[model samples]
Target: MHPSRALRYALTLLLLPLGNALAAQVQVAVASNFTAPMREIAGRFERDTGHQARLAFGATGKFYAQIRNGAPFEVLLSADDTTPGRLEQEGAAIPGSRFTYAVGRLVLWSPTAGLVQDGPDLLRKGDFRHLAMANPKTAPYGAAALATLEHLGLVDTLSGRLVQGENIAQTHQFVASGNAQLGFIALSQVAKDGRIATGSGWVVPTDIHPAIRQEAVLLTKGQDNPAAKALLDYLAQPQIRALIQSYGYGLE
Candidate 1:
């Protein structure tokens, strides 16, 4: 081989491991309602950036406690804007690293077709034997559910018939498995392409409750982690934003 060409080949061999070195893993704590879209985005983020995201999904409120107690999560995608802001203010998360990633829509859903016709009226009639919802203290969606119930003046009436789940995912499972006649859940849980993918659901009006603005924040643990920064940046891409929208989340 020619000397210069041979030298170039040797240099290429020396630099080959750098590619793998540049790839890293970030630990993420995500809200349960964002499960599906986050999985797809994580796959794409790995493919496009060569970095891996190690994800843990659960209630944002629980995640906040875990983070404060020194969980190893480098990032948090909270179900509500408040938790992330609280973290930022408390110094658990890096300042100026938080942003709203998705605006969630709450829905009254049932696995049975037509059971949810005129959702507000159905609640008014108190016909269902059981209604499921997440634990209001630990889940933002659950809080919204209560706010909605309060708006419709059904809180007292439905109080006796309500079932609570530990988190939004489990709450959804309750309704989906027919354990409860219906539940209040995030629209993204059973929706795609601007429609519910299965079962029947009534998209609750924005006027009834506070907006569900989900936020992402880089935890102090991720401040210097390249993969953590990469993951946050990937979430802001137009393609990822479109994917979020397809799941029935609103964007600003």
Candidate 2:
């Protein structure tokens, strides 16, 4: 072959995978607490960037554990900072990859049964038979509820009435199924953008508990992945930030 043609063919072979890499999709492990907004953001990202993102949601702790065990996740959107920070420290996450995407809020919510009005008064009055909270060990929302109750001096009072869910979604399910009279859950589960839907809820005061500051990070495994980078960047856009805020979360 002529020298120019041979070089051109070799370059084309090398460039094919690079072009394909640019079109590859990114897979993300997202927290259940971020389910709604992430779904919305994913749609916008795909539409705007021509990049696809596949999402999987569960408790942040569980997701982190899975990622550590070699789950094929490119990014992690955690419900708290600790997990992502730890991953970064361990070099599982990309160095300096962590940032707060949103600050989560918790609420005392009940389906429209009119059984519980929105307030801390329900606890003081001893009006409810059961309350659902996430498990304080692994779920950030559950830990917040525990802190809130501890602040109110109601943990001892409600000890007999408390029911714990593995995560916020289960806590919400308990309330919705009428298995629990009320529950402490992430605000995004039942409302968005300062708007409440079918359920009646009381926004738990930030003073009552530690803030659920959720942080996200790109995994080291995703460094070369465009979809992961796109998502991390997509999260900071004004429109996406506004949508996140609408879901009763604070924009970072």
Candidate 3:
């Protein structure tokens, strides 16, 4: 090999490790309702940007407490806008770094066909032995479900038969596994290609419950992290917004 070519090859080899070193891995705390879509987006992000997103899925309220107590998460994808806003106010998140990512829809779901009707009458009729919902204190979707029950005047009558899950994902499992005849869950949990994929469900009206405006924010730990910023930017892309919508969420 020529002397110049040999020096150039050596330099290229030396820079390879440095490139790998700069590829950051961001720690993200994600809401359980966004589990599926986040997984897809995270994979694409890593592939396209050479940055990894290490995700932890759980209840938004619980994640909020953890972040406040010094959790090392670089980003927070909360199920409700309130939590992210509060984090900004409390200095847990970077100021003005928050944005609405998706609008979540609440649904009443059952594994059995025709078990859920188009309206709220089924909940009032009390035909099912049990109804599952996430813990309202921990999950936004759970809070929405409660609001819906209250709006339909079923809270007093159905509280006795209600089963609670720690998060919306678990609440979905409870109904999918037949542990509960029916359950309230995020539409994303059971929807695909703009429709419910299996079983039966009622798309609860917005008026019945408060809007589930999901939001994402950069945490204090991620303020200077390039990977964290990249993920946030990637989420705001039109293609990604369309992908989120395909999962049964509305886009802002």
In model 1, residue pairs whose N, Cα or C atoms come closer than 3 Å (at least 3 residues apart or on different chains), thus clashing, are none
Residue 151 error for model 2, in Å? Answer: 0.4
CA lDDT, every model vs. true structure: 0.90, 0.82, 0.90
Return the TM-score for candidate 2, rounded to 2 decimals: 0.88
Of 1 and 2, which scores higher on TM-score? 1
Per-residue C-alpha lDDT of model 2 across residues 76-191, encoded as one tens digit per residue: 99899899999999889998767889999988888864655746788789887899999988899999999989988888989999999887777888999999888898888888
lDDT of 2 at 4: 46
How many clashes in each structure? Answer: 0, 3, 0
Can you rank all candidates by lDDT, best first?
1, 3, 2
Give the per-residue lDDT digits (tens) of candidate 1, residues 160-191: 99999999999999999989999999999999
Worst 10 residues of 1 by lDDT: 1-10
lDDT of 2 at 161: 94
- List candidate 1 stretches off by more than 4 Å: 1-18
Better lDDT candidate (2, 3): 3
Arrange candidates by TM-score, highest first: which order? 1, 3, 2
TM-score for each predicted model, relative to the true structure: 0.93, 0.88, 0.92
List, residue by residue over 1-252, the lDDT tens digit for candidate 3.
234434533443444456677678899999999999999999988776677999999999999999999999999999999999999999889987788999999999998988787658888788889999999999999999999999888899998999999999999999999999999999999999868889999999888899999999999999988788778877876788899999999988
